[model samples]
Target: MKRFVLLVLLVALGGGGYYAYRQQHSAGQEARASAVAQPRAVPVEVANVELMTVAEEVEALGTLAADEMVVIAPEIAGRVIELGFKEGESVKKGQELVKLDTAILSAELKQAQADLGLARDTHERLRSLVSRGSGTQVSLDEAIAKLASSEARVELAKAKLAQSTIVAPFNGVVGLRSVGVGDFVAVGKPLITLTNIDPIKIDFRVPEIFLSRLKVGQPVSMRVDAVPDRTFTGQTYAIDPVVDINGRAIRLRAAIPNADLTLKPGLFARLAITVDQRLNAIVIPEMAVVPDGMGKMVYVVDGGKAKRIPVELGKRLPGKVEVLSGLTPKMQIITAGQMRLRDGSAIAIKDKPLRTSQL
Candidate 1:
């Protein structure tokens, strides 16, 4: 009977321990379920919606061109006696640039002048005799005709003499000369090149769709591979009235001040034309934007939870973007830790909120 009592007590103790263990296990599972139901907040970085100045810009490729360029050539062929200009040097308008041998031209001019003088004397003598009724009217008429012809010859000779000397047509820089002193050149042969580049012009083409936005006097900025460290600024001066049929583009020209003469013609240029600008525009960092199926979305912190909001995008800046719609100022936008976020997911800010001015 004593042994039976001991066995029963031991069984009862084991049963109590098992019942307690079951209760504890059930409670632990319930705690785990509760924890899952209420997840911890996701940490993120946030910034306020920015209200700043923004510009609408269009980009294009172009080539630099001189304001005025011309090939310096002679109108009359002759032996080049003297060159009045040095290559790669600046010259003034009407300055002597080249002189051709004018020995034959000068002699012809002098003979023509002597003939004009003789004809003038004969015409005068015949006029006097006709007035006094001593010379026939026909003779006077012949003398008058001869005098006119002689005068015309003299004028032609003078013109030919002037053509032997070439003068600069405009203020510009002279390029390399193809012919030098003592070199015989033919008529219309290119002697050198003259370029006027103080106020340089750049020609670029833009798509026809941008025609309405483009106009004269719009500000433009440009960069070139040759001048990497500097950015040149100018304004649109001309737009082609007719669209290019082959390329469906409109040609544009801008004038840039190049007093220092740093920008050279034929250099490849990258152009940015500012068509529109706004002083008060809503902006946000680019990283805050998320791509949805066909649209874009961003997360905004509202009441310690992330609320995904769709946005209409505008022109993009360096690392920021303009918000055209669906967002207002002072909204906190998540810039980081967006991968784990869903609509209405709880968020814990990891740092101080950045203001628009700070951006």
Candidate 2:
């Protein structure tokens, strides 16, 4: 009887332990199910889409040029006697630049003047004789012709003498000289280069499709690799009337004030012309945009969940972009932590929402 009681007690203890173990296991599984049903929110940064001023711009690559440029050459062959200005110096309009030997020309002018004086005396004598009826009409007419020829000769000599001195046609800077004193130069030989660059020009071409939007006096902004830190502003002053048949582009020219002479001709330039502008246009931070297949997308937080939105983009600005569609003002756009986000995924605000003013 003692042994039976011991065995029964042992079996009852084993059954109670097993029942407790099963109860604990069931409770643990229930806890795991509840945890799976609720997901942790993803932390993300957000910004508000707001209306702001946006510009419609056209961009093109161009080359810088001088407003006025010319190659200075002699009009007549002569030996250079004097150089009035130094190389690479500013010259005023009508300033004397070069002087040639005028000895031969001066002698010819003197001879022509003497001949003119003699001709005038002879003509007067013939006219007086004619008035007295002593000279024939044909003789008086020949004297008059001689007087006219003398006058023409004198004028020709003066013109030739004037050509010995070369003057600047306009206010500009002179380049290096190719001839020195006592060096003989033929007519039309390039002697120097003169350029007017205070108001520089930029030449660029745009596709024909933009012709309707282009106009004279449109504002243009330019940048160059030589002057990387500065941005130059100017206005469109000219457009080619004819389009380039091969490229289908129209050429444009802009004038930029270069009083400091920092910008030089022949430098490569990047240009942006503001063709149009719109106030109260939808704008957003560039970071909020995500590239989708053949399109662009962004995440906007609504009801504490991330909603993927497809957007059409317009002109791009500095660190910002214009949203033409699929977004509105005052919407919270996720700018950060988008890599782990999916449509309708729960999100937690990581920081204060950015406003348009903040951007």
Tens digits of lDDT, candidate 2, 274-321: 889889999999999999999999999999999999999998888999
Top model number, lDDT: 1
Model 2 Cα shift for residue 84 (angstroms): 1.2
Candidate 2, run of 10 with poorest lDDT: 350-359
**What are the lDDT scores of the predictions, listed in order?**
0.93, 0.92
For model 1, how does the per-residue alpha-carbon lDDT over 1-359 read when each residue is reduced to its tens digit?
99999999999999999999999999999999998999988888999999999988899999999999999899988999999989999999999999999999999999999999999999999999999999999999999999999999999999989999999999989999999889999999999999999889999999999988998999999999998999999999999899999999999999999988899999999999998888889999999999999999999999999999999999888899999999989799999888789999998897775444433
The runs of at least 3 residues in candidate 2 whose Cα sits more than 4 Å from the true structure, single-residue gaps closed, are 1-51, 286-312, 325-359
Candidate 2 residue-wise lDDT at 286: 97
Clashing residue pair totals per candidate (backbone < 3 A): 0, 0
Clashing pairs in 2: none
